[model samples]
Target: MVAPLSAWPWENLGNFKYLLCGPLAVKVFHSWNYEGTIEDHWCLHVLLICALRGLIHQLWSSYGNMLFLTRNRRIIQQGIDFKQIDGEWNWDNFIILQALLASMACLIFPSLNSLPLWNTKGFITLLLLHVAVSEPSYYWFHRFLHESNLFNHYHSLHHSSPVPHPFTAVHATFLEHLVLCIVIGIPMAGSITMGYGSTSMIYGYFAIFDFLRCLGHSNVEVVPHELFNKLPFLRYLLYTPTYHSLHHTQMGTNFCLFMPLFDAMGGTLNSNSWQMHKKISSDSGKNGRVPDFVFLAHVVDITSAMHVPFVFRSFSSVPFSTRIFILPLWPFTFLFMLVMWAWSKAFLLTFYNLRGYLHQTWVIPRFGFQYFLPFAMEGINKRIEDAILRADRIGVKVISLAALNKNEALNGGGTLFVEKHPNLKVRVVHGNTLTAAVILNEIPKDVEEVFLTGATSKLGRAIALHLCRRRVRVLMLTLSTERFQKIQREAPMDCQNYLVQVTKYQAAQNCKTWIVGKWITPRQQNWAPSGTHFHQFVVPPILAFRRDCTYGDLAAMRLPDDVEGLGSCEYTMERGVVHACHAGGVVHQLEGWTHHEVGAIDVDRIDLVWEAAMKHGLRPVSSG
Candidate 1:
């Protein structure tokens, strides 16, 4: 005896039960039999529904950020801007392409196997399974991406943003998106094919998946501490916004999507993740206090394995001929690298705050190489921008572009940062002015004349002008006298009269003071003239001949008196030297300039520069 169509719903579709499944069962049931041809009738309708879901998600994401930022900016993670999307490639097109592909995939998935319209479970069960499986699958796949060669070639795009947003959740490669479908799709498709899911379950799957993706990428944090410690099992099943944001900021931690079970078991949990989450969630964002300026150092290289760990970095630091000796221990070295990566990933804090009485300073990991290399470094600007954007989100008042970081930035001197983000609250400074100020302060008062190298350089020009203003005759040294002298002649009268342009370093031998305005490292202690009080602005002082006679930095200029409530910090063996740009950042924040300062080193602005230096506790040149 054959069963009727209505009877089939109760008999064939059994076990799981849900009230929401009624509409889905009816829709699919009627379409398969009563409609004669399901394709002609429901294709456009399904497409329309998919488009609406996409539109709704985008609108809701924007609305959510504004609502939260208005009520409390603290709860928000990366804010509303999409810095990661502002690259060479068009993201909107890619996002649209992905959505269309996903919709197409959805249409194709159901047709492959006729599913039993079973109302197996409610919306709650659907939510639980996606979270439980999504993160574990995401955990292993993401780990593979970072650990393999694909990191630089492809995965770097998704990791570009230090802070994630809802739009960024889908900002991945087409291949990656397809792989994601397989990773996230197979489980759901299996359950439905086995007569466990109804029409509502499929809808529930997409709705929950999209939401958690946005929630994982969003700046908001709703998972409280009590949920984790009070109910430990929940820790295995839930993930907070703070969890994923950290993965973006500091790579190699919190890789799971909605669960921490895999990450904890895999030894990739960030120790400071919870504390940072608490800080972000608890902030009132109303206190009018001076925020810290975060600085990230340049990494040694972008195209090499040096960014991973000390071992990997050290291994690549050597010559290839010498590197061959260590090749025999590849297996052992790999194991070591894995152990170190796990320990560091689990416990290390990549950022630190150097606090003073008046203000605070933050420093992040090195993104580029340790020293300046002649090779072309691609994708570095984006990395630096990510750090700057991260700093902006945390409310950094000023960002100091340090060392080679200044030269590597967009058009150098942070012009790219300020131009790209006109309304950005975090101020960008090259620290050139304050550096010039420190170098200028090192000049001996008794000298009648001084020799300035790199006279065409911004720092060189500033120092020359300061010397001329002080009535000290300036001898400008450059590689080309004809071209530079013509350029130098255009300066104000007060500067031209006291300046003499030459094209040789030997001209400075007669002068009592020699300031290497360029980034020249010293090779020999007696390289300078015997009595010459030579000051070097380039770091890692080539020669520390004498504290007062041959100073090696502009940032650590010792002041006679302390400003604000901080102590006077002179260039010493114990305290260490501060970068001129970093010191300048302290000054810029205290001075509170009216306009943006790309690299301010004007002679007129020298007065406050000195005060700003003193406030940061940098003492003037002291003879040890």
Candidate 2:
């Protein structure tokens, strides 16, 4: 299928400077019968254009992310919590898909041989027609997918990115991709049918096509509402980044592709979507800066998602018409309240900046931290994905999960999240390495033997092993001897003498100190005896956090002034109690160390103290 240089679409397509830059070697011959021109310079030309589009998209997405991470308000600009985002990417999305699909389209469709690229009215109408027809088609198609069971099977993967990115726009099912291809093909097919063929038009249409898709999925809002307000119909012409972001967050609303008209007419547009758009847009330009690292937290539900305000608890027992007024309407009222609560959460939700006592900032990537807990446990995987996605969207360089987030995410410590979202640009930290350093370093010099709880758990095992290695006596406790025996079997022989056991912590009067593990919190045991010291690895805000029976028994512990950024607050919005698991995660990410010791459960894997501090971009506490 070799064609002479004179027969090629070259001059008819007018001039594209980029295409002209490459070599014109028509000396090559083709042998594939009909699959386009295999060895032709035209194929090389098409592949180059696809490559150019990809490079542009990557740059665009990265620049937008830079604005989100460094320009916007750390907390408030980050729409959803970090865990609410689902994240995954691969080379196929970055290059292979675009190139393969574009090449296939080039061979099958009436492309470069058509007309010159610059028919202002012709190609513009083609792009608009593509959007116009694709909008309703996509809306109904997408909404139907969600309303039906097809979501979990196929559509769910695209929805997985609750915080969308340009690359994420094409990350969909094969069927969805086919539908999208047809939707895009509609205008091109129409143009050819209407007797309008231009190589420039086809290339122009696709470049615009990929650009719009990428813009819609970007983290930064490129089209502000002010533009819509000024022009009015522009809203029908353009969809901002926030517009698509809302679709991902609400999931049940904003289903249109290129514009909001379809969603508005269909009544699925979220009520608060506009307000969120305004808020995020207002934080643009000079107001859009963020830091290198910030704590992104979740709104953390201490109660049920379907629950009413706790202040209304006493109202349940009230006698207002008592049974007459409250009893009958209770079910109806409950439904109404549930609807309103969900509405408010959906529309009004905003992440806040969590400031430390030292004025350092932490980004709350989510509204509530409990998305992975209680009845919502079924969707823990999706919730975790959403959080990471949101963090990446806001340009958060590093994020640390708190409380239940850590519980569900730290299976292999931070390895689970790292493995799940390997392509995410932002760093995922457990924040445990620093916590371990603080607790271990504070092992009071006078103490000879230390009492430890939950020896079988990850944190407990690590602490016990580290203590034993340091030649400090560790009184390990467990519900049964089986786990203890396992630990004994795995321990180095010389370390056995440093490990002991006690039937009850109350009876260990000889050891006034204790190291409380996360697992121990749920055990409901009294690890805190009167006149004792506790090194708590779990956040103090946890409801299960226990206090010594003798009010003044447990001693107060503080992070050395150097790492004052870490520790719990008792009065001024208590934040930062060192959790060994979270600390270890921070260390692993900061040091760029590869420690998959989660299964092995070893504290030695944690690089704490001065070494961690040196790399943390913060000064160490005065060496005293």
Best by lDDT: 1
Highest-scoring model, TM-score: 1
Model 2 per-residue lDDT tens digits across residues 29-116: 2323554555444555565566667665665544544332434522223432222222333312334434456556656764444356
lDDT of 1 at 289: 38
Badly placed stretches (over 4 Å) of model 1 are 1-290, 299-378, 408-410, 519-527, 544-554, 557-577, 615-618, 621-624
Candidate 1: deviation at residue 93, Å? 62
lDDT of 1: 0.56
